[model samples]
Target: MKTAEYEIVRDFAAQREQVYAAWTRPERFARWFGPRMFTTPADRVVLDVRPGGAWQATLVGEEGFEVTLRGVYREIAGPGRLVFTTGDPDSPGDGPASVATLTLEECEGGTTMRFHQFGVNTDAEHAEQARAGWLEFFDRLAEHLAVQATSSKVSARP
Candidate 1:
């Protein structure tokens, strides 16, 4: 049976490199990479941004539920594209692992990030929940990027 798939596109008022770094770098990733009700501590995230490199993170939810996510990078095309496979460590993989592709385009205002994931959970409800979670995560990411940009400007001032 084919699994559910989901896609989300978000535009940020930040450069492609800044957005890409926020996704690929461990410290930056942990800042905005989990569900809104969860916290992904920086020290609990391990990332390697190269082909075949592995990544793992532990998310602690507000209700005290903890989730561990693991993935491997399949490709990294600098500030434009990234492909990876991600899954919960405790879940049994009945079929193929979920593969995600992120494409970043530099636009006049900032960057547009297209996030697509295939072979996710088998149910539509799960996909919907995942989509909502991603939306929250992206909102947080945008805020983080905006703050970073402001800080950068402040630090650059003479």
Candidate 2:
């Protein structure tokens, strides 16, 4: 039933340091990474950003309700690569965990980063939906990365 794998490659004219920071830091994580389809909590984010660390996020439901996502980081290859699961409670079992991989490569202008989500086939419709969802998310990410770069430089200026 699971039958969806997708890859989105985006190269930013932003600085690599800023791009790397946005992906690794939890503060930056909340700004860009999320469904963003509904009203999401910008402050309710906790990502350890390391192997064996926890990644938690909570979104308030209608009329004071809250939904949670609990998972752990499975792999970390420094600034170049990162692999983790979003909803894997026990992580690395028979059940497929959503695998998120980010790769950063330097380019002539700035940096080329590829975002890949490889597992999402629980159902035919779900797989298709995920593909569409990731495409939208990547678009958001591109904008966020650029802003992050500009903000960092402005803050660094004395």
Candidate 3:
């Protein structure tokens, strides 16, 4: 048996509130959940961002390789932290639904986020790849935030 712990950090060019909004809001989520060179469009997405809510994503690429991921939101700390457990709740040993925590800290010019995932010691291989994929997605999120911030500023100009 092996254990795996993977974390991700990102500095977005937007305020904490905006960053948080992008995650909790469905429309915003559909916009940037996809990474560069990939598209996790709104059509193939389902997000319920509340305690005990479900989060699902199925990315269709190439042939019939569909990636289905499901999770439940356990704790939400406004624009600061979001905690969740992965895997489905109906099955025993269903990957244990590892606990994941995403925290946002206000920085000088923007927001810095730290993503911590635990309870992965039960399954190391899959968790490792998931972490890598998450990092890539975060990069795309950064790009989306940058553009969104610019748009917001432009719209606010009087």
Candidates in order, TM-scores: namely 0.90, 0.77, 0.84
How would you encode candidate 3's per-residue C-alpha lDDT over 52-158 as one tens digit per residue?
Answer: 88887666656666666668899888799898777743442535457778999999999999998875435777777778778887877888898898898899999
Error of 2 at 106 (Å): 1.2
Clashing pairs in 2: 2-121, 3-121, 61-65
Q: Which stretches of candidate 3 lie over 4 Å from their true place?
A: 34-37, 88-96, 121-123
Candidate 1 vs. true structure, TM-score: 0.90
Span of 10 residues, lowest total lDDT, candidate 1: 88-97
Cα lDDT tens digits, model 2, 1-158, are 25356777888887667677776676776666655653345578787888989878776656877777657778888777777776662443555457778888889888888877766434556656776766766677778887877887899999
lDDT for each residue of candidate 1 in 9-123, tens digit (9 for 90 to 100): 9999999999999988889999998977789999989889899898999999877889988888899998999998886322546733578899999998999999998764457
Q: Count the backbone clashes (under 3 Å) in each candidate.
A: 0, 3, 2
Off by over 4 Å in 2: 1-3, 39-42, 60-66, 89-96, 156-158
Clashes by residue pair, model 1: none
What lDDT would each prediction earn against the true structure? Answer: 0.86, 0.70, 0.76
Strongest candidate by lDDT: 1
Give the local distance difference test score of model 1.
Answer: 0.86
